[model samples]
Target: MTAKWREREKTGIRMGRRRRMDMILFNMVREELRGRVRRLKPDWNQLFDRANANKSDRWRCW
Candidate 1:
């Protein structure tokens, strides 16, 4: 099987027609977010720290 199929199997992500379209839109938004982050050119370590902190807070809320 292809790598994409392998990844889907590992993640248990079964995408139907509607989900496929949603994924396409999600990817477009992700690309836009990446572009904006690249343009800012912030410190990588600082970004990592912030992300980690946010993730911790998110888990706490759960």
Candidate 2:
């Protein structure tokens, strides 16, 4: 392979690995938060509460 093609392949591999790591970390954190909300007191879990259907319908609350 040409030097330029080899360099591009190396970069692509590195980027793929980084993307996978980011997705893994994101899923781990999301699961952790879900677990914490389930175990915590109701007051502490207000953000995750679904009491207000109207708030959820919007694209962005903030």
Candidate 3:
């Protein structure tokens, strides 16, 4: 492969990997938040309550 084309190919591969990683993390977060939605206390505000919780989502809510 020519040096310039090799560099472009590497860049494309890196970008594709990063995008896939981002999509996976985003989906995991979405499903976790869905669990929270089902069990959230009525008195708490969504943003504040999620932020102030002492445990991680997996531990406490999700």
The best candidate in terms of lDDT: 3
* True lDDT of residue 62, candidate 1: 17
- Model 1 misplacement above 4 A: 1-15, 38-62
lDDT of 1: 0.49
Residue runs of model 3 more than 4 Å from their true location after superposition: 1-15, 38-62
For each candidate, the alpha-carbon lDDT, in order, equals 0.49, 0.50, 0.52
TM per candidate comes to 0.34, 0.38, 0.39
Colliding residue pairs in candidate 3: none
Model 2 lDDT, residue 2, Cα: 71
The number of the candidate with the highest TM-score is 3
TM-score result, candidate 1: 0.34
How far off is residue 33 in model 2, in Å? 0.3
Better of 2 and 3 by TM-score: 3
Rank by lDDT, highest first. Answer: 3, 2, 1
Q: Order of candidates by TM-score, top first?
A: 3, 2, 1
Superpose all Cα atoms of candidate 1 onto the true structure and report the RMSD in Å to 1 decimal. 9.8
Q: Taking the tens digit of each residue's C-alpha lDDT, what string does model 3 give over 1-62?
A: 57776666567557685465456556756766776776654333564465445543222212
